[model samples]
Target: MSVIAVNDGTFVSELEGKGVTLVEFGAVWCPPCKVLLPILETLSEEYAEGLRVLKVDCDESPVTASRYGIMSMPTVIVFKNGEPLEKLVGLRPKSAYTNVLGKINAEAARL
Candidate 1:
């Protein structure tokens, strides 16, 4: 699946009933956020079956951002069953993300 744009209104529901979700809290004006977009898009497609990737503009979705305690731009939070599982701040290597997803998948399988 392609990257999904999420707002305050759709945040909660989007996370609900999902297996695993990676939410990027960022703003368009932020350079690092811009740099991270394409990486997330590619991951979204590569992990299509096991993960769901969503983006939330911090400037446009303040409520969702605050709820997630996003003090910095480009904070990526991974969620499972609507609960946050892991959080990564700033720009990270693609392998870093895949590593987290791998752990989540393993945990899910064990459960």
Candidate 2:
């Protein structure tokens, strides 16, 4: 699956009130942000059962970006129960995301 586009309207209810949310804040102009799209998509597909992966374009959704203090481009925030659990800045390997998903899955299993 592809990354879901999120905005101020849906950010809170969809991310905070729901289950795990992996939100990526980025701008279309950023090269690194462009590069991370595929990885986000892959991760979204891999964890579709338990995780909600979305993208908030900094240009399109400034309110959501500022709410999270997104100073840099391509900031990845992982949220559980509406609060942030992890923030990954810059470009990272696919394994970096899978590791986080694995951890969340383990925790979910325990719960």
Candidate 3:
């Protein structure tokens, strides 16, 4: 699947279902956020079966950003069943994000 752009109005609904969601809260002005976009796009397609990728521009969606206590751009949050499970602030290696997904996959397997 492709990364979906979300905002304050659509954020809750987009995350309101079963499965895993990775949401990146960022802004077009942030250099690192720009750097991370394609990485997320790649992951979205690779994990298309079970993961959904979303992007929220902080500048355009302050309500969503503030609700999550996002102090910086590129705050990536992993959610399961509409609840936040983990958050990574700033730019991180793709492996760091993959490790998170691996853990989630493990949880699903155990269930």
Candidate 4:
């Protein structure tokens, strides 16, 4: 599925269900945020069965950004069961993302 663009109004509801949700907090003008988009898209496709990837434009969603304490561009947070599990700041390798997902998947399997 395509990455859903989330705003302050939709942020909580977007994260309030079953499955794993990956939310990327970013701004339109941030270069690293631009760089991370495709990487997130690819991961979203790969984990489509169990993952939901969403994006929150910090410039447009200040309330959501502040709620999450997002102090930098391209901050990726992994949420499971409506709670954050892992956070990554700046640009990172695909493996960095996969590693976090792997752990979440494992935990999910145990439940």
Candidate 5:
């Protein structure tokens, strides 16, 4: 499944649901952000059962971006139980994300 695109008005509500969420704060003009899109898409499908991947156009959702302290484009914030769990800036290998997901899953299992 494709990553859901969210604006400031819909951002919080989208993340209000249960489970893990990876939200990318980026803009259309960012090159690295464009490159990260496919990676996120693949992840959204691979973790469809346990994860929700979302994208926020920084230009369009400045409020939500600032709320999360997004200082740069292509910042990915991982949320657990509707709270910020981790933040990964810039583009990263798929394994980087999988590693975090693994940890989240392990923690979830422990709980």
Candidate 6:
């Protein structure tokens, strides 16, 4: 499935009820953002049942970026229980995301 496109209006509401959400704020022109695409896609597929991955195009939706205070491209925010738990900036290894997911899952299991 394609990454869900989120914007200023829908981002908060959509993520509020969802148990966990991973949001990527990027633009098509950003090289680092492009590089992170595959990683997000792979993780999205692997954690389809538990995690929700969404993308916001900075160029297309500046409001979303501003709302999140995203000053750079490819700002990844991990939200758990309607609040941001972790954030990653720039190009990072897939492990960065997997590790976060693991933490979320582990904590969720204890709940």
Off by over 4 Å in 3: none
lDDT per residue (tens digit) for residues 1-111 in model 5: 569999999888889865799999999999999999999999999988689999999999889999999998899999986899989998999999999999999998998
Number of colliding residue pairs in model 6: 0
> Please, what are the lDDT tens digits per residue for candidate 4 over residues 1-111?
878998999898888975799999998899998889999999989988689999999999999999999999899999987999899988999999999999988887898
C-alpha lDDT of residue 5 in model 4: 97
Highest TM-score among the candidates is held by which one? 3
User: Poorest 10 consecutive residues of model 3 by lDDT?
Assistant: 10-19
Q: Per-residue lDDT for 7-98 in model 1, tens only?
A: 99999999897989999999989999898989999999998778899999989999999987999888999999899999999988888999
lDDT of 4: 0.91
lDDT digits (tens) for residues 1-111 of candidate 6: 547887777877778878788999998899999899888988889887678888999888888788779998899999987788898988899998999889888988998
Score every model by TM-score: 0.96, 0.90, 0.97, 0.96, 0.96, 0.90
| CA error at residue 25 for candidate 6, angstroms | 0.6
The predicted structure with the larger TM-score, 2 or 4, is 4
Better of 4 and 6 by TM-score: 4
* lDDT values for all models: 0.91, 0.86, 0.94, 0.91, 0.91, 0.87
Give stretches of model 1 more than 4 Å off: none
Q: What is the C-alpha RMSD of each candidate to the true structure, in Å?
A: 0.8, 1.4, 0.7, 0.9, 0.8, 1.4
Report the lDDT of model 3 for residue 92: 96
The CA-based lDDT of model 5 is what? Answer: 0.91
Choose the strongest candidate by lDDT.
Answer: 3
Which stretch of 10 consecutive residues in model 5 shows the poorest summed lDDT? 10-19
